[model samples]
Target: MNYQPSQNDIVNEYIENLSAEIAPLFLEIRACILEAGPEFNESIKWKNCLVYGTTKNHIQTVVGKGKISLIFHDGVAIEDAYGLLEGDGKKARTVRITSPDFNRAALQDYVRQILQRS
Candidate 1:
């Protein structure tokens, strides 16, 4: 993809550029992140979505052609009681959302946990 992002780039532009199937779910995932806390800051970086906590970025969303990937920065340390997070990376884990009906509570819990740790 020839994505040349600028300083004025926004999350809306990223979402708008995605396919119809992925855009709505992407927005829902972003909504879940925002619901976690009022202190969570949002920014568009590397043509992806990022939600930052008070200290560091809690999660980064990669909107693909079919699915939206929520990559948790410190996912290896998190306790996934519900077993929703995927990937087996040393430090990060990914939660791929193909539908709009993802686990918002889990996402919020993750954000809160990460923020507390930070």
Candidate 2:
């Protein structure tokens, strides 16, 4: 798929090296986030994590053994109507994806809300 022009090469490498077990789910989540907010750019942060944003970081992707965690940087401000967001940190919330059939609608909603806020 044609992604945004701002896509970073380093982030591309990171996604390319993802384990077979989580790559599909990670790609799906990446597609969902990009589709929901086409203006966002991708980059690798903290040496390993993939982060998405416009001018500043908004969402962070953390890969785990068998799951992927999407961390909304300003998640505290986004509406959680679907109750999919987790965490009680000062400003971040996470959505854990473990399977291919994750909640796309809710994920898209969160992405849109973050875009609107930005």
Candidate 3:
């Protein structure tokens, strides 16, 4: 199997150039996502920060413009647990991720679920 840089170069560049106003949150979010695994991937997709799983996990988390989000590429797998998920698609759900209003246990559970699905 092959592996890729977790943050690609863009995510690193973004983090490097983020304004002080949002840099801390970006750092926090980056730290949170790093919980995935040393082998997990980090990259840019659709201009968003993407953390790709090393295995068969169905998630791709991104910190976008005004808010951060976790993309449940397999929505049905976690919809019942993350009641806040919105969208009517067979394969995706958007999850808002603001640390101040975030649920750590639930987020951990979500990450755990993604890990288990593989």
Q: Whole-model lDDT, candidate 2?
A: 0.87
TM-score per candidate, chains pooled:
0.80, 0.92, 0.70
Clash tally, candidates in order: 0, 0, 2
On lDDT, the leading prediction is 2
- Model 2, TM vs. native: 0.92
Error of 2 at 88 (Å): 1.1
Candidate 1 lDDT, 41-115, residue by residue in tens:
667765466555456777887767788788888888888977988887798888888878788888888877777
Tens digit of per-residue lDDT, candidate 2, span 1-118 = 3333334778777777888777777888888899998888888888699889998899999999999899999999999999989999999999999998999999999999998988
CA displacement after TM-score superposition, residue 39 of candidate 3 (Å): 3.7
* Deviation in Å, model 2, residue 42 alpha carbon: 0.4
Q: Report lDDT per candidate.
A: 0.72, 0.87, 0.61
Candidate 2 off by > 4 Å: 1-6
